[model samples]
Target chain A: MQVTRRQLLQAGLLATAGLVIPALGRTADNSKENLLLSSVTDKDDKNWWVLSDSQGNILAQHLLPGRGHGSARHPSGKSAVIVGRRPATFMSVVEVSPQGEYKFTDLTSATGRHFFGHAVYSVDGKFIYTTENDFDNGRGVIVVRDISNDYKVIAEWESGGIGPHELRMMPDGHTLVIANGGILTRPDQPREKLNLDTMKPNLAYLDTRTGEMLSKHELPDHQLSIRHIDVADTGRVWIGCQYEGMALDPMPLVYHHDLNQGGLQAAEASMDTWRALKHYTGSVVADNQQGIIGISSPRGDRVTFWDNQSGKHLQDIKLRDVCGLIPSPNGKQFVATTGKGDIAIIDAQTLAVTSESRTPELHWDNHLQVLA
Target chain B: MRNCLLILILLCSTFSHAAEREPEAYLKMLNQALKLIQPAHQLFADQAEELHNQIGQLCQSPSEDSLQTTRNQWRKTMESWMKVSVIQFGPLLENDSRLRIQAWPIRARLLTMGIKQLETAEAPPTLEQIAQGTVAVQGLPALEALLFRTDALSGLQQGQACAAAQTIAEHLIVLANTLNQRWQNEFGRDFADPVNTPGGFDTPQEAFDEYMNGLVTAVQQIKRRKLEDPLGLAGKPGKAGATESYLSENSRDNLHNNLTALILYLTGGEGYGVDDDLIAQDPDSIAVLVLDDRIKGITKYNKQLTMPLEALVKPATPEAEAQREVAESIFKELSLLNKAFENQIFEALGVTRDFNSEDGD
Candidate 1:
């Protein structure tokens, strides 16, 4: 890695940030560092997609006109496409160079539809598949964009449920798995669930190349709205749920289903812990190397770990208002963020905090998209 | 060196001023716990203790006068419990103490089973045994059944039921004292993290989030569970006993107290008033003030529901329909308040909703 004059100046300004903070200028020399990407809000309450180095040093920040949710890092390792918060119309394709220079191109959802705040870039870096709403039709959709040609909308398909949220590509690289959270919301009435009486949340799988629906699974209890998800190297989908039923009812918040197994397996936990969760699980990620999964519950104020194969409750580490969770680039640890801007790196084996960092001023939002 | 560099980066890139506003809010939270929540719990404990003594005297020599006095004290104690119940976020949640005191959406099976055991058992339940008893007989609802139910109260007036009633009150007093102690000694300190290190709160934003989340959840619970559920506003047939405090018929007053606190807390009357600051921070502060007004409006509407919630929900008369209208108003206001909470409060505090928080979902 070459350190140019530009790099030295950038580091100086970053280190000697006076009361009047300077804009973080990108260095001309490319430095190979593991950068972590996530959506953030600044002191003025504006939203941004921020990139931080492996040690949690701020690198680059790109402002979004609206709030952002989950982001999709392109396979080419060159850029990321971050979608705006739901009922969201904007998606910003952010370019991150090895030299720490960050740029972005903004795109809008089709009329009468919007990004559900999650998308997946093609493994070959040719296209982007975004979860969207066909709001007028009362169905969800998957819109394919040709990345080479300005993210042009090339194709569309039903998302197989009402409100499709987080989606990821399967290990096969062509099969896209989606969590279709079956709550209807129109732009006019943003974030309002119109159909709790008849919500039909499901875990859906589709072939990315053809938009062909291969499989879809719904919870037996319809009130458990399937939302955020993470797919492992082995294609096991760990799903999280937010229950719309009675608050105190005991409901399973974590589930896993292997694509080949064709059956959804519920993670087993004591009724006490499940009750403590209050029918809410925020983010779900699989620590593939450690053979475990971690789920966060901001409502319960705890992050719980579960064994991947046995679906057994492994451990619970408590934190207030914590949500964003990402397994480390190595898969040997997990980095978790909260609504209060606290970050903790947990040892995957012991489920213990290795180190904790706090950004008392900024609230780290939902998903942390790790970039290598 | 690594820690130093980390601290330098955190200090340089992050804005510390945003954290400064937190102490005011943090102090406000401590004020609420001390001024409102602690005193409310203490009053409930005192009332429960007084009720126990009254029940003891009544049972020692049963009379219409003595028993009526005991029944009246029971009503006072139950209402006092409801006032303290709104502090549902912290220590009250520990050991399922809240449920132990008064489990609502009340279940009759536990009451029936506990009642039969209390009346027919060879030995009257010791406090330890009653403490160990299923949650059903351990709370105010059991007292409601024992006092209001004919066969059950007969056992109590006959001196067969004095011990269980006495035990429940003693247990409630013990819980109240523990709650006050925990809030004072530990949980309240934990709630108001003055320095962010050892304080359960890592930062002021966290303390704010916890406080707002608890308050919003309480308001929603009152609007949906306490009022709308019994009113059958969601189109289900409302049941009579399903209303909170159904036996005592004070669910409306419970709503009033809840709405008052919700309004008071948000308006900066109690402490950590986010509304005034929210309004001042943005030209669009009207939205937040309007939300506060809506919350206050809930208290007014609560007063208009002169009929018991159980009665209002059971019959479809004009008066019942009017009460349902009040319920709907409260529901809509609470819904807007919830949204304002996520949007206004989040913006004022410079925070974002964590992934998949029920707010955005």
Candidate 2:
């Protein structure tokens, strides 16, 4: 029987109402290196689109719950899991055929609540890690699921932090990292309750298998929120925040971390500290290959480029409400999206807009995925 | 197998189609609501600003006469705001997105208070009025804050909220226990006489109705008492109001009971047998499904739902407003569904069955 993703979820729910118990396959961990790269609409409206790269062309489509706010390719490059946008729910598997057909299997709903940013597939491709908002209870839970059986949940963990939004599996393979957004809201009426009492963003590291919180590095209390994050191949994690509402007191914050004797210590700010950056960061991608890291703030209408080697702001591109940004597989082009749903392709080297496409049907084209 | 697959495809398609259509429908509904309220909001904002300035001036002068003048103006201004702001919840209830309706009571209360506070020396509001407004504004947000505190306290295990949520959970437990005792001591009858619903006994609607009304009243009283104490243990150092810590504790204690009362009543006498009629089947499942569908449906039915709310709240976009509307509608429907579900559950226990039937009638 070809069980649909929703059915799998329903069946799983029936098995256990309170806890999500996953269905495990016998050979679930067997290595399958065929990764699919196809752009399935995480959300639709043509102008605002999140694309997945196949060879050189971008396949454009919208997902039902909407486009992914974040996506991570499986190392084998055959499949990828995406963290789709709000009222946060599921992590969908974007399966690519050799022919490049996109089939999405609902992997797991956000146990923590709504998912915001990227979902990273383990380097071994055995598991997928993602972050989510636990709105019902007013916190965040970090969920890890096994993709072996089409997609079934394996284990789940909590961030021990409030509002864990984005996640990336560090290149170290053992460490699963998360951005613990420090915003507190009433569990039920999130809109009304914005209590900043115990608010403090943290970069949390956890064990992939045990779901044990290994280490937590907290940021200054003043940094509004640590939301989206990217981990470099060299094991450096770059973090970003969506400063507390439009009043510029809390501009977007970015910092790199180093594990030291006192624990994870924040490295000195690499570039001119961004003091006036407004609702600026939704996407952060650190390019290990190109030696540059990119941070895009669609609300700020700018994408700041940083020279990873020198730790400097190379340039900034203004794309209003820029939602997604990812390097092409060949490392020659950078693909990005705007809230208005425009796809701006820029040269990897010059970082200049080479071409732009619009998806009129797309409303909130959020994150991008690239299958190598 | 092929037929099964076909049915599966049909179900999936139906759901997706429903999903798409639901948001649009919600948008339409909201747009209409926005049209009805936009003029009023603008007027409310203007008048509110002016009254606020006047109140500020009165606060500076500090006299009974100035206070009386400010108070009188506040009352007049408040009356105007209410006239302009009172949402016809009937339309929201009837619309695809019922969740949006849930916030109306709360938001209405806040706006009312915003206008009320303007009268620097108006006659003190009756305890009943204060209690009602405070409960309305504080209900969901307070519960949520407690939940978040639970996570912090419980150490992020879904169970963490249990400790703080315990206070609320305990209250729920007490309500369930009391209702059980009432049935045993007085009625000594099965929750329902039994008509044909899935579960044999039903929470006699009368009993369930009384239970809910009394519960709201009792809740209001507690809130009033809470006002007297203000902070209790969680009181702030200098602030007269409750401290976050104390409020968290209070919410924790109270929320559990509320939820338990809700859950038990929703379950239809399966847990304690207070009223079989309250819940017929698994109230939780039914409530969740209904809430899910309503939320989804409201989003689809946006045209009717979004306009009025947009006009009222003045959110950034039609879609964002629609999202909020659907969420509200889901929660509101869930509250009603939850009550019904509890009635189903309690009815099975054959206790306090007829207590509330007349009230609804």
Candidate 3:
């Protein structure tokens, strides 16, 4: 019998209350339960992939060869892949068993390409698509890898712009929406931006089956590098930008693109709110059940929430160096992680911290993923 | 169960004891820093007002002496700004006031466009009109362009250009005055009494972290943006125009004032400071020792930079190459200072450096 997340949450609560249910314990294996996954750097500067429970307790951890960025969970719910940060050459695949044991397989980047720190698995979990940099050619490409064949490259296609950072498969499973960050960099220079004066960032929707570009929508300002995105259930694409212009210039850091409307609209916020974000948004996530979208500004040390339907600013919560954000397993709360080694569970409706924990030894990275 | 409870109580008391002592030290340091900061802002406002008065005289009399007087006042006002620009928190960051006061490494094209628009307007632009205009036109850079540039110096004599200069000076007075008043009033009181006002920090450690982060960022801006990028010490091609205060030829003086202010902040002028607290915590702290050494290194090299930074970067001249070497030495010392803060000082203080502040996407 398959157990749902709601059932597990209920069981965990009952156990916490000291109520003994013999049959429930036999059926629900506590060791197999996982809540969230993130890449963490310890005080020693070593990197690890950490899986934790809802209460922020570490369930399992595996060391990575290098620092990892965003992660993709397999549809089977038994495995996940961690990609290295920009100009990265390694990727690690982690498989977990029902007994809570973990296995790891590492993959190397193809010649003349490096991972841009994000990837998404196909709906069937048969293939993974990664955003990569064709640095020598000064272009971005999406490489399709077959999961069953040692994660080998099956095909490749243009990412519709220069520096694609993150991509997600739409609900339909065949459409991939990509955030082309639009800042060019060569491998020799690595993190230095090569094209700030003329960077044109865009949101591109591609037909995965035929490798054809469906539509591409560019931001109004060429200096706003579209870096991260999330798709709401209502078919709206939420974008987070890192501005490359003068720090004093006022620019909206969050935008949304509606598939039906076919253009990008800035999320409405006051000028002070825009300044408070400090011109960089590290992550964007949508809580469909709560009808709210969240954007984390690590530079501002705050997380801002917006109403998904209207694209209007709702509220702001102060969390020092917060960047990683995701919906809770029950879909009623936001599980946020901070670079200062904090994890907070925020009630979606009230926007208050219901619970929080700190691990002083570990610094969480930019993006968080549900373990599935 | 009784023994376990006893042990827990003992642990709690020990943790509480350390936590209680830290806040007191932080408050002392904060109070000293504010003493320096509050007065600096007032001087900045006063300097701006004097600059405005001098510009008015230049417009009415149209003499070179008055023009030179206004230019000298502008430099004094810019120095005041550089001293306090190291402050990266509180009212300075509240409404983009810092940018309105001085936007540096300015876009020449944008500044030209803004001045042209201001000069060619049908009527004299009001303070409200200038305030609502682009930040490029409303602050010190605009005033600098109007007062110092060869083509714009003529505008100080008469016509719409004189009107634009007077209007921008007026805007600077307002911006400077607002900053001064805010620091002297609620913000200053709240900073001094963090426990009662909370001042957006739950504990004194958080406030200290913010203060340290500001100092770290100031050092970074000095090294990377002000020196290395313009001087080509960081592997990028050198560009003289990239230097801050390039047109005013006050770039070296800007560095001197910034370093002096940083030293005041770290040593707390005449009162208790981070150095005192660190020594009290550990008499033989390595962080404090290394920090003082780096500070000495910066001062030594900074004094050696006799020429303006723009002239130092010009290639193929022996004197320019010699000056570049001096600038490079200062950059190296700054790099070490930044590392001491990130690695040693923060670690000694048990402050967790946030990853995003250090490395962001």
Residue by residue across B93-166, what tens digits does model 2's lDDT show? 12111121112112333433432342232443332333233222221232233223322322212322222222
On TM-score, the candidate that comes out on top is 3
Ranking by TM-score: 3, 1, 2
Rank the models by DockQ, top first: 3, 1, 2
Error of 2 at A110 (Å): 7.3
Compute DockQ for each candidate against the true complex. Answer: 0.19, 0.01, 0.34
Candidates in order, TM-scores: namely 0.74, 0.45, 0.89
lDDT of 3 by residue, A327-371 (tens): 865567888888877877788889987667676556889889887
- Tens digit of per-residue lDDT, candidate 2, span A133-195: 667676677767666664566666888687777788877787888888777653245233255
Candidate 3: C-alpha RMSD after superposition: 7.7
Docking quality category of candidate 1 according to DockQ thresholds: incorrect
Off by over 4 Å in 2: A1-63, A107-117, A133-139, A185-193, A245-247, A250-252, A261-276, B1-361
lDDT of 3: 0.81
- Ten consecutive residues with minimal summed lDDT in candidate 3 chain B? B11-20
Q: How much lDDT does each candidate structure score?
A: 0.73, 0.45, 0.81
> For candidate 1, what is the DockQ?
0.19
Q: Give the per-residue lDDT digits (tens) of candidate 1, residues A154-198.
A: 999989999999998888989999999999888888866889989
The better candidate by DockQ, 1 or 2, is 1
